[model samples]
Target: MKIKSLITALAAGMVLSTTAVKAEGNAFRCAEGETYYMNVMVSGVEYWFPVYEMFKQAAHSMGCKTAYTGTPEYDVNKQIASFDQVLAKKPAGILVHPMNSDPFIEPINRAVESGVPVVTFAADSPNSKRISYVTSDNNREGAYAADVIAKALGGKGEYGILENPGQDNHDKRVAAFIARMAEKYPDIKLVARAASNQDPTKAYNAVLTMAQAHPDLGALFMPEANSALGAAQAAQELGGKIKVMNADVNGKILDMIKQGQVYGAINPNQGMQGYMGFMLLFLAAHPDLIDPMNDYKRASYNPMGLPVVDNGFAVVTKDNADDFYWDAYLKRRGTKGIEE
Candidate 1:
């Protein structure tokens, strides 16, 4: 689809409409002393920017301020330290995507105990004291990918996975996909599983190695978009026989899907995650609003419980690939929120 047509589709959804929504809202006051922060490792990754942008949008709409700060590289210790550093400044609240589940337990606990509301997004620490967790249902995403690919191949072929192990969300995706295949399509054999670390080159090399090992491999799945780029290139070079499916979408991935270089993608509603994440933190931070049922100053328990929000996802193929582009969404929304 052309950029113009995509914009029209988005406008029809009422998400954003060329300055229509932005102009009407004074709900976001940006009042003095009302600021928040988002902390995550791998801030440089393409998938994260939209989440952060929508977080900002939610903050702005709610009359608050937000800033982005986290390690540019994927280093757990560094991210933890950055979390502590952000704590010292004491923003209204924080939304963090921990590199690992247990490593973030201490920092998240300390943040909550110190009265700084915290929520986790994308990746989460279930053992931690964070007030809320927001993300797509990763298990559902993996199952959907498996269903799409297995049915596309008619359920009797070998497939492989390019995995980024240990990260909670990525691990869940891989595990769920494997389980789905085993239970529903026993005829399909999983030929290989290799580490990609969310790197394009590594994924490229991994796919090539899988191809060499299983010459009759039918398909390959990765949990994230970055690795899909490399996997797509490798599939293209291998005469496009091995179908490639992955979770998440960006411009390049959508382009590949449209061009038939890649088969499909599972697109999480990342914007909804970001927006709801901020809302969770903000409400937790300011729990002074009167409750109709409860008496004044409800104490002991934090304002918000550790709720999990599954923002949901859409399966993207060539037929609707154009609707998932960030550039078109930004243009149609009429907000200069995210940079290309």
Candidate 2:
């Protein structure tokens, strides 16, 4: 019996030693004194900063470090500069939102070459060597908006497309919206298109201008939260005459819906995109779970698929606005209801 006990103890010690060795085998673990800064370069904060905030929090939860910074404007050069700055520190992974698709190719490639993992969100640089792009089905989102507007109108009338023009996701959304309108609802007329540049003030002015010019404009269609916010305010001022349907629901936008100003919004889970982007990078450092040689497993090589993950959205209307997401809305934007 004594000999048997000794053998069991020896076996347990061997197992523990092997487990320790396995744990120590990762060559890419962030050194004890090192930090894996996750650089998040997005277009602007006010519009989507909640997402970045959540990402930063998620990284902390996962025991990973991060840096969330972005240029206030949608300037590609500005975004590239942010990228360059983050790359200089040689971070563990990067979650970026390339304002311009074409300009980011070389910089993203440089990051990958330097052995840094990069993932993009909301938009993508498809031509770049980056591994993934995390965004929703933008084209589908546009198409969905088109269908909603058509059905709400019960056939057709003049409508306007609100977009940012050169942004890849906006371009795709507009194209899909128009295409769906042409194919499925041929009778619907997509009239004046306004480039709001994703700014609330610009969107407001644009919608007001278009509304004054095109008295017959039936509804406002948009894929951006800011544009939707502006359009809803305009339509509300005009007595909700034009049905406003759009994507990305913000706290203010939701209130408009409750008040019968904004008709509805396709709300995407921006938090999830950010949360996942950080995870991909954090996990990539874990060589045991992610194979370095496999391009699909690493964020650096798979950013093309990540920068635009289809973080889902749902339509919010007056009937369901109360039950929708008040708590999440308050938490994300750091605002409370008028009563609160």
Using lDDT as the measure, the top candidate is 1
- Our model 1 lands, by Cα RMSD against the true structure, at 9.9
lDDT of the structure predicted as candidate 2: 0.72
**Highest TM-score model number:** 1
Estimate, for each residue in 176-275, the C-alpha lDDT of model 2 and write its tens digit.
9899999999888987987887777888888888889998888988777777877777777776788888777666877888887887876656777777
Look at candidate 1 and give me any clashing residue pairs. 28-63, 29-63
Count clashes in each candidate, considering only residues at least 3 apart in sequence or on different chains.
2, 26
Q: What are the per-residue Cα lDDT tens digits for candidate 1 across 60-140?
A: 777787888899888999999999999999888999999999999999999999999899988889998899999899999
